[model samples]
Target chain A: MIEARGLTKRYGDLVAVNDVSFEVGSGEVVGFLGPNGAGKTTTMRILTGFVPATDGTAKIAGHDIFEDPLAARRAIGYLPETPPLYPEMDVAHYLTYVARLKDVPRGRRKGAVDRAMERCGLADVRRRVIGSLSKGYRQRVGLAQAIVHDPAVLILDEPTVGLDPIQIREIRGLIAGLADSQEGGTGHTVILSTHILAEVEAICRRVMLINAGRKVLDGPLAELTRDGQRLEDVFTRVTLSDQAEASAGGTAEAAEAAQ
Target chain B: MRHVGAIAGRELRSMFVSPVAYAILTLFAIVAGFFFLASVLGFDAQVAEAQQFRAFDYLRQLNLNDHVIAPFYGIMWIVLLFLVPGITMGLFASEKTNGTQELLMTSPITIWELVIGKFLAASLFVLLLVGMVGIFTGILFFFGDPELPKAASGLLGLTLVALSYVAVGSFASSVTRNQLIAFFLSLVLLLILWMLSIVADLGAGGGAIASDGLVSRSMRWLSSADRFEQMVRGLVDTKDLAYFGFMIGTFLILTKASIESVRWR
Candidate 1:
């Protein structure tokens, strides 16, 4: 489980994450929906212990991310906005390296690599150099690396960005299969951030929407989309309400000044 | 330690597989080869011409202890100055350019592990390049009476210089995404240090007051060139070792700090 309270990240005078708080329990698939530069990536970074929060705390698997980063990180597998890859290495070599870095036991390294490659549909391209592979293949390689260690919490930032429709569908299927696999029974807890609302509606059980670094809404996807409301409509309504409130405050301040 | 080794191994493999590594190796070898050949040929010609004179023979007798290995130490310094930067220029710059830094920063590994891993990998590549030069220097054993201890000391000096260069190069790479900029930054910083020693030599020759000489002395103390010179003379001073160690530690810390700062922004 991952829990954050009053999480805030500030850059100089600008606030990237503003008093945002959320939680993801075990066996849950939560979608993080936010537009570009809406603090989605920053929040994810904080959760993964990649960056420290200016104020508040984040705990992963009952360990405070700041106080016990190694433990928290060991329990989480993160794929950032861009897939980290060494272009010079073949897919197999790269995956093996990541497995070792992720602390996969020596005896289980090959099995872990093979399982990751198969699950991510990268078995055929294992011997191919990552630089020679197309973007979709690279993305698959990234996915394979992320789950190679079999971390309980998987945080993926914009995993489906810049992929063809077929590739997207295949990746979505892979994530779904991973979440519903019978081996562990209770699927891995996943927190996927994306601007693609449709994919979230299609695959996510719960969704958290943030606009301008603040959480605007959070609930089960089915319940949030009830009353014949599309996910897009709900997103627009919530964001537009925030903008309206801000403008109304501005006008009220002007009126007070006039008085 | 395992995490650091894993990262270093991966980085070393990447260097071999990439075209840039081969390009750097080839360029350094070709340039250094020409420089070595010219210097050796020129010295041999001068020695042969001087051998014909009786006075020269007496001078040669007096200077029988003159070591031909000393000149090679100079050549090694030149080669290292030119080559080590290229090996390290892309260490962090390429990651930034390719946007892979984000991936690394988000990984479970600590900042120190990442920085030290990259530093060691780049240093190893520099050592490999120096090893090739060592093989070339080995040929001197067949041609003349070469001082083995001095030669080994020179190689040690080269390694220290290479380590210092890699640290600066890695720091430069961390500061920018552009490989060219990283290269230039490292080059400029090293050049300044090299020139400072020369300026200090001038100051010691009566250009500056003894009281104000501390700046020049400190600048000379920081220079890789001066340390290399001392090592080549068979003196492994603790101060020189400490200077290089401090340099390597400082840059690695800078790299770690830079990487950590990325998450905040």
Candidate 2:
């Protein structure tokens, strides 16, 4: 469902996302693990068509992002690091607008919106203004937005980052449910980025670890943890390798540029 | 067009749902009303003086169109010039600051569609501002015998002026995430465009603008204020329309290009 070939991004002399590539098959949930400046969000942004790759190709369900961005983007449901939401807009109105932007048919919009809200557990706060909601509720709204159009692929960046423990668990269960066809949320190939190793352990079936813009590891989660080794020791053993130089600069630029 | 409508509706909803739409409308109406009242009082005083001195030449030529409507439209033109930047400053900048630009850009829409959608929303709001001018003119049709077409033409010109500023404001807003920066950038650009015609007429650039050399004529041709003044005189020249059309089209294209260039960076 997602294919990336030598995707790279550069700013001035800094290569924020180097020539890195990987592919995720349909309906597979992959965890993108990286440190503070591991180019995690940058890669996700490239895949979601939020940021253009400086070199090479990205395709969503066989549609090249650069060649036919709208089509490629249409198949994607993205939740950026910060939930892209309007503060003054209520939950239902905001979701409806996202539905329209994602090209849900006029007649089915209400149904799609209702299903997304129900899926995200946002029904209780449907009429509440987004700004007035707590962080967890806002995160759910962002998730609801991503799935509103029922896009085939979901690219979520740190969806559970700022939520409380219970909120995190709920969000994880929602994601896990989406990944499991038996849970009724079907056929969503998700690529979620996070620094939380336990998050990958909880929901993601595959692990793709990137460090300093290069993919250091990619494999089945079960195989990597087959020896009962803690994912933390493995992550530390790999990422703590000599590739940890000058990573902080990109984080600064990331916040500055995204703003 | 569907994409454009969706984006525009989102923008319009954001404006109206907050205090933004009401604030802009009420402020525009109050300021425009004061300008109308001032112009009416000035015209009445001028007419009374003319009649006292039996100045027939001045009186014969001095109708409401000349004394009241033209100056009223000019004041409205300047007022909108200041107000338009405020309306458009947050159109794109707020999206960036709030991170909504990420969602907007990632969605299935082209930059041209985004720009046009924003331009349409700003134009629609300015259309309401022009409607306020029409409401003020409603009182004129009652007691005064103003030339209907002439007054109507002035309002049309005001609308075009506001729209042209909208295009410029859209471009300005697209360039930055800071609302204050967007506001000042557009205000300065509009002021430059407003002053260009006066500067083009000085020194060796005198006589009719068309009779001048290419450089002087081009500056005059590019001067929106000059064309807007012509429209207020009840003259709807195709040249004026073409100038506004060309300017609006250019600025909107530039607005799209500015946003598109962000991906490259």
For residue B203, give model 1's deviation from the true position in Å.
Answer: 3.8
Q: Model 1 reaches what TM-score against the true structure?
A: 0.94
Q: Report interface Cα RMSD per prediction.
A: 2.0, 1.0
Cα displacement (Å) at residue B111, model 2: 1.1
Rate residue B197 of model 2 by lDDT: 70
TM-score per model over all chains: 0.94, 0.94
State the DockQ, from 0 to 1, for candidate 1: 0.65
Q: Tens digit of lDDT per residue, candidate 1, span A100-213?
A: 877899999999999999999998999998999999999999899889999888998989999999999988988877777557467789999998999998789999988878
User: Residue B163: error of model 2 in Å?
Assistant: 0.5
Regions more than 4 Å wrong, model 2? A182-185, A242-259, B205-211
Over A163-231, each residue of candidate 2 has an lDDT whose tens digit, in order, gives: 999999999999988777754656799999999999999999999999888889999999898999888
Give the top-scoring candidate (lDDT). 2
The lDDT of each candidate is: 0.83, 0.90
